[model samples]
Target: MNNTDHTTATVEPAIRLESVTKQYVGAETVTALADVDLPVYGGEFLAIVGPSGSGKSTMLNLLGLLDGPTEGVVRLGGRDVTDLSETELTDARREYIGFVFQDFHLLPTLTAVENVTLPTAFTDGQYADRAVDLLGRVGLGDRLDHTPDELSGGQKQRVAIARALINRPEILLADEPTGNLDRETGVTILEEVRRICERGVAVVAVTHDELVTEYADRTVRLVDGRLGEGDDGFAT
Candidate 1:
């Protein structure tokens, strides 16, 4: 092949949405997303920003495989998963995706180390050592014995982040992850997330905070269920 052809060879995206749409069929039909096309590449951070009810949550669900599209396809590693059985989807989700929510979601009764190792319950307990390492990586080594109620907001969020990493997923989907924290605390949380992206995991965060745009490799705006232009070139 010529040099130009070699250089231009396309790499499959970690996750992709093709002409996707999501709608609710309650009393009256409501469209949450419409014809959304997006690509999340490994080792990059993509931010989804929008006003309230603009479908940011819907988009996150689709990306995380928690929900299927009403139309079009959702692909993981370039393979269409829009028609997978529930059991297959569950397996794929456990193997390929991790999620961090706005609420720390740590069990108030469990110690930080226990919360981080919870995912291992689904498989063998061999991930115990890795859980400890991840907690240290998130700056929670000294607070492993503390429960959610005992830790500060930033620390709790850090624990949540460490918990998300236990499965060693290829994609991390964060929904308003910094929403509950103060600006300074949120910045720290975002820093930890940036480190995760640096480790070659595809990170997609849905947020209303414009500050997150600064940390993203690309930012795409959502408006009334439609995707707007995306800004690129912020990668370190």
Candidate 2:
């Protein structure tokens, strides 16, 4: 390879896996991800799609740092996550990762603004204030004081998204973020996701919904713990 090729190869992937394999042992052993190699760049919207038990959610969880692989290396921005201690992994998650989920997991007791600001408690000065600003930016300024029950489903989702963005992470990992919403509401949430990607946050969402791919910059299909054929696509 030429020097340019070497340089390109050295460039960091925002999220990456090399020969990654995941397995669970119960009464029997099951492989959830097998010899997977994937890369996500710094500013892309990538969707992971597949049927049930196809490893889509497992991939998301691993990328989100919610779980570690049984074998192989996982890297974030060139850092080797697999080699990190538990405390280091926890700190890395706080500093570099954001997560959004389908169920709109907002605390019913807290207001929207509080929900967004909650994570900031573990962070430093001005964190709470920044969370409030994020909520406002997500168009929740008027609903800041509303609890989950006081808001519409979509509004609650908006709050959940704002909460995810509170730390301004480099990558946003969303697991079936629209699964609980109606079609229109789902689109609205996805549009917000697209907006986040526009701002240069890499977004990876796991979903079974084909309509969601329309918003993604790239689509990857997983099947039986492997990357399926012809699963790669660029924006048309």
- Against the hidden reference, what TM-scores do the models get? 0.93, 0.91
Give the per-residue lDDT of model 2 (tens digit) for 60-158: 888978789999989888677987888888878877788888888888999997898776776676866776788888788888888999998888888
Candidate 2, pairs of clashing residues: none
lDDT of each: 0.88, 0.83
Write model 1 residue lDDT over 39-69, tens digit each, in one string: 9988899999878898999999999999999
True-structure Cα RMSD, model 2: 4.0
Best by TM-score: 1
Residue 154's lDDT within candidate 1 is 90
The whole-model C-alpha lDDT of candidate 2 against the native structure comes to: 0.83
Q: Rate residue 229 of model 1 by lDDT.
A: 69
